[model samples]
Target: MYSRRDERNRHGRDLTFSLLTPEDAFELLAFETAERAWFEQHIEARKEQFYSSHGVSQHIIDCLALNAQGRMSPLLIRHKGVLIGRANLRDIDGENASIGYRLAACACGQGIAQKALKHLMKEARCMYGLETLTAVVSVENQASRRVLEKAGFDAVDKLPDHARVADRRLDCLVYRCVLRQEVECA
Candidate 1:
């Protein structure tokens, strides 16, 4: 779990990050339902069942199982005790992991994404002992690309015709951030 007071918002509420639990199924459902259109614009399409309660419950179960095996960290972002978004560190391979995040449609304009990402990066290094983190964003997603850059990530490469978005193929930009660098000794 990670907690930090954020002063960026007018409410001045502390932001809390925690592992996704079964208890959050309903809140997750609501968040997904509300942000479905907004998210689908930038992310891959979700199954029809994923919008249902049963599917969400199963997702929660799967996330918990992955957490148990230490292969992923599925996190829920909260502000003032309300579920506002999600951030995940997945595909863990010794000191490296892929990072991903999404915010509620209403939560977009603010600096919340950048703040949450910065905090996650810190936790990834200190708590999880991670040395490097990576993210891939669609070339058309300028906002997301900016978020990654503001969070100290550098665009290392671009893959043409990388992914299929809806009916057409789109390019993807790969960004990476090294949290800690090892020093060479004499």
Candidate 2:
């Protein structure tokens, strides 16, 4: 039921969630390059080579491979024909997966991440047959924590000194959400 660039979920009307594809390499590269510092503030930084065309292509290929094997789900976020961010479901084991997202600086504080995340939760329940979704956020990232809270994730645990950001070690919080899909009658 998902299309190339028109996938819409119930969270909001302005955001589009589409499966990641090889065709998005360059645009994805630009978005990532522009938001590199912003992203590294809260999460791990990508290697320098990952900013290049070949690196992105290889990354897409590798992600698609995992998608084909039912091990990962990578999504691209768009707003009115512009690439804005990426939301991903990785480490997918039966009934469980880890979720993460990065938003462009311009897109942050605009409720786009919350909507994208809720849309991702729906995809997890309906498309991937996943029951539990977990997210890890750095303690200093209050915006992301608020977004997750608004999207129905509850703080479950904290990992001490689990992440390093801006040359300093920081604690990370683990958030979890359970989905209850409705059963359809035959």
Candidate 3:
């Protein structure tokens, strides 16, 4: 039931999501090493930054472990052969998809998120037959909110007291983008 055209149509244009493989460990490890050091010196001293505050948990380790086992696909963001960040197209729902990303602090403000998000969105529509994409962003994280907004996601609601950044409660913003609408507009 699948032909070359079908596969192409299902997976979308030439824009492919470069999958993360164990082979990527070297580059990922390098980025993480550099980031952890940078965080300790700069961002960590200030009220605990995003990646620094939570760091990586056993849950993430387990998830990556499962992903390495081929249970999921994680798209990596690489520039000039360097691992800059990663995003996962988790929880695909027939016509909708949810994704999460973590970028190297050094890669911030470089529009990497935008490029990654846009690529995923396009892939979701063309390949996954998805109509919408969603993401939950911490309200205090204005940079991420801006990135989503720049990618045409609309903040639909304010989830109050939904997250705890330490002892203080933090709100979360629910952002969504209609993939079909974007494609049609494009």
Candidate 4:
């Protein structure tokens, strides 16, 4: 339900976001290809990436389909028409929303994650009337946690033994960004 008009109200559209649609699948697929390759090389064998045969490619396709059905908003990160990664706002709960993202490993450390998150936050606030957004990061994923912090999400809680990663119970850190605080900053 996020709107470009809300983005205009906060700032200009260029500084905010553009919603993703099913028509953007090809570009999204490109990023997914890169991400899946990176995961297979570095994360899969280590059991860090817990994806099935459906893979990132298929998962992206599914996300796009869901977006088209108004079930989610999955935005691909693009710079000059080149896809770098993807971020999504899902698990909607009335005024609250949950977010998650993945990037090609080569694209990491470039601030794209933070940029995508900032854009999504604005969209959620304006379009969905969302007051709170949350991100769940693996306890050991310092890099992802840092990205969330950079996007103005603060560690709000910790879910102990919340996920099974690589067959081992792992903790999860919950980070939250409240729209009221962001509006105050503006």
Best candidate, lDDT: 2
- Pick by TM-score: 2 or 4, better one: 2
Name model 4 segments beyond 4 Å from true: 1-18, 23-27, 37-71, 181-186
The best-first sequence of candidates by TM-score reads: 2, 1, 4, 3
lDDT by residue for model 2 over 48-155, one digit each (tens)? 899999999999999999999998999999887788899999989989999999988887766788877877788788888899999999988999999889877999
Candidate 1 residue 80 C-alpha distance from true site, Å: 1.8
What value of lDDT does candidate 4 attain over all alpha carbons? 0.67
Q: Taking the tens digit of each residue's C-alpha lDDT, what string does model 3 give over 1-186?
A: 987656534433322347765455555556666666543332212232223313333334555776555444478776655667777776776777787777778666656667678777877777677888888877878887888998889999888877655446677888998875546323
lDDT, residue 152, model 2: 79
Where does model 2 exceed 4 Å of error? 1-11, 182-186
Candidate 3 regions off by >4 Å?
1-17, 36-72, 166-168, 181-186
Task: Please give, for residues 1-186, the per-residue lDDT of candidate 4 as tens digits.
Answer: 657546333332233234665465555545555466564432223232324433444665777777766557877665545565667889766688899776667556656666677777877787677889998877888888888887778998999988655556778889998876444223
What's each prediction's clash count? Answer: 0, 0, 1, 1
Per-residue lDDT tens digits for candidate 1, residues 1-186, read: 333333365433467888999999999999899888888777876788989999999999998898888778999988888888999988878799899999887777677888778767876786678888999989998988999998789999999988776756889999999985432211
Assess each prediction's global lDDT (C-alpha) against the native: 0.83, 0.85, 0.66, 0.67
By TM-score, how accurate is candidate 2? 0.89
Better of 2 and 3 by TM-score: 2
TM-score of 3: 0.67
What's the residue-level lDDT of 114 in candidate 4? 69
Candidate 1, residue 10: how far the Cα is off, in Å = 4.1
Supply candidate 1's per-residue lDDT for 83: 82
